[model samples]
Target: MLVSFRLPLLNEEMDINDAAGIQALLEQLRSSQAWQEAVALPTAPNEPNIVPEPEESNSAPSASVAELLSQLRTEPDTSTLDRPSEPTPSLPKPTTPATPHLTPLTPTAPTADLSDLSRHLTFQQALPVIANLSGNPNLIQTLKSVRVLLTCLLELMFPSQMKDEQHALETRLMEERKAIVTKYEEKVKVAKTKASMIGSGMSKHEASMLSGAFHKELKSFDTERVLTAWDGLVSQQQDALSQLGIPIMFASTEPSHRESQQKVIQVLEGLL
Candidate 1:
């Protein structure tokens, strides 16, 4: 840069041949630099010039977030400005109806005759009666067995025609059975007594008599006779039941009804 000034000075200020002129040019350059050090200079043309903004002004500056919030709090809302206010809809109230008076109904009795003899009875109808008569589920099975034997007997003999003869025969048989049992007990006791007496030194005749009487009494209570009598009475009752068309439940001879019959028999036994 000093060379640029030196070239112009060489061309116009002084003669390069004179040494006195060269010394004078250097002295002028130093003086100019010294004067510049004593005085302030403006910014260079290449640099930006900045000036401080004034703190106080008439026009408002852009607001900070805090200032904007406070301004909003102090100001009235403009969002709903010029808009009309609407009325809320009124809802209708519900109305309840008055309660009505009700009449109580009475139960009516059945019109059918329950005891009509001509009514055809099924097992369902008869079972209850049978259960009632038997009074025990076990007895139902025994009654069924007796009925079965009686039915077989009825196939070979004539049935009774007397009114309620079946019930009468049953009652008579039960009484006879009781009597037989009592008589058997008495016979057993007498036989035991007579044998005991014979060992206590009875005469030959008395001994023979006691032995003969004991054997005779023992033979008198014939099991087969008792059974035959019972069978006869049952046959007559069976005839009566057949005459009435009463069904014997679980009495089917078919193997298909076997399980049902067993179940019915069991149930009857329980009822009895």
Candidate 2:
């Protein structure tokens, strides 16, 4: 009887336990006559003598391969070849690196012209302009013009050091107004004190009488005299401005005079 055995080929994917079983199976076959015959088979005389050189395999096996060989050698069981192997846990997939976020730069605002700021200047703005122009010979005309304009505006607004007649008239009118207010205030205070002493019964009637007297005094107060004094003060300022060649029109209505003054200020500001 002819005996034949089929052997499976070993590959990298074969489990270490399975490889050990295959190695044991090969050992069993080594004692068989057919294995002995196959190993003793003679080569033809013309065929080259093939020899494996240790120097050709001088390079070491990779770590994975060495580790597989180690596992196979350590395992003693051959029956495990018939059993199913535990599945290997899969490795996580590599993630793409996140792109870095960048904040966009803000564009700068346009620079404003220095001269454009003069449009909204108050009377106090003159001081800085005067200080800057001082000691500069080339700006003498500008300095003089600004000084005169500022002086005119100040005199028109405050009206100090009036002519002898105008000053006396204003003083007299102010005194009269003060006297009227003082007299009424004194009377109201007396009436309030008396009512408080006499109790609430007569307080209402006293308050009504005081109120009437106060209103009568206020109505009698000469507002026309104060207006006349102001008009005289303005007339004096107009004369002063004319002497300085500022030529503010006192004869014009209040609104017209204000408009003219604004025009003059604009012209003076342009000179700077």
Candidate 3:
């Protein structure tokens, strides 16, 4: 800071050459209560306007606050309607978190009789495992990223040997899925029992309120969980479709016939 506090015949004098000078000036300012009080005083009416000097403020849009408000009112916000009232229940602990970088898309867990490993071949069983894996994600991914993951998934699932291996992969995935479900069931049971424990201690009014709240929350929780599961399944199907070009008009087996079919089938089979 450069300052000439003294009102002279012509000009006053003060300038800080470096940080040390600035620090010393600050210390002096802090120590002098009168200086502090003077600094705190409101600016003189005769002083120039202190509007912030935004480098490009003049070049930008200068909509008045009222106009900006009117513009805001013109656009409808759909995000509010799309938000869920409550989140899904916490499921069991997963072994490894899914990644946006999963080189080949695959379900982490199978959806079929995963418990019956013997019912299907190992390769066939892997599809669901890959799908389940694909579903798990950190806080970073969006719906679009999930879609991109499907491309890698398509390539992995639609291999030439898919039919031979699909069932086995499916079986393995089902087994892992059963384990996850069992773990989550146990957690839900614990939460339920804990929830019940709070019931016996309340007055009638409290009981009624708590009961209603829990009922509502539980319903929401269940719906959220079910929807999440359904979404994961649907995502798998969507990924399959994205790879196969819809109806898979490219099959060699018939006019069944013209292109991305085999890859699409491989992708869906892996999800099973």
Best by TM-score: 2
- Per-residue lDDT tens digits for candidate 3, residues 144-246, read 2232222213333332233234444445555755665565556556656766798743356645655576556556644565335433443454434334323
State the lDDT of candidate 2 residue by residue for 77-177, as single tens digits. 45687677878988889999899898898977658633334323443554465455444554444324322222223322212344444547657887988
* After superposition, candidate 1 runs with Cα above 4 Å error: 1-200, 203-220, 248-272
Please report the TM-score between candidate 1 and the true structure.
0.22
Model 2 poorest ten-residue lDDT run? 52-61
Alpha-carbon local distance difference test for all models: 0.44, 0.49, 0.40
Worst 10 residues of 3 by lDDT: 1-10
Root-mean-square deviation (CA) per prediction: 24.7, 23.6, 44.4
- Per-candidate clashes come to 8, 0, 36
Pairs with steric clashes in candidate 2: none
| 128-229 per-residue lDDT for model 1 (tens digits) | 765565655544444444423333222211232332344465567667656766765675567668767878543577556656765554456334544555
**What is the alpha-carbon RMSD of candidate 1 to the true structure?**
24.7
What candidate 3 gets wrong by more than 4 Å, as runs, is: 1-202, 245-272
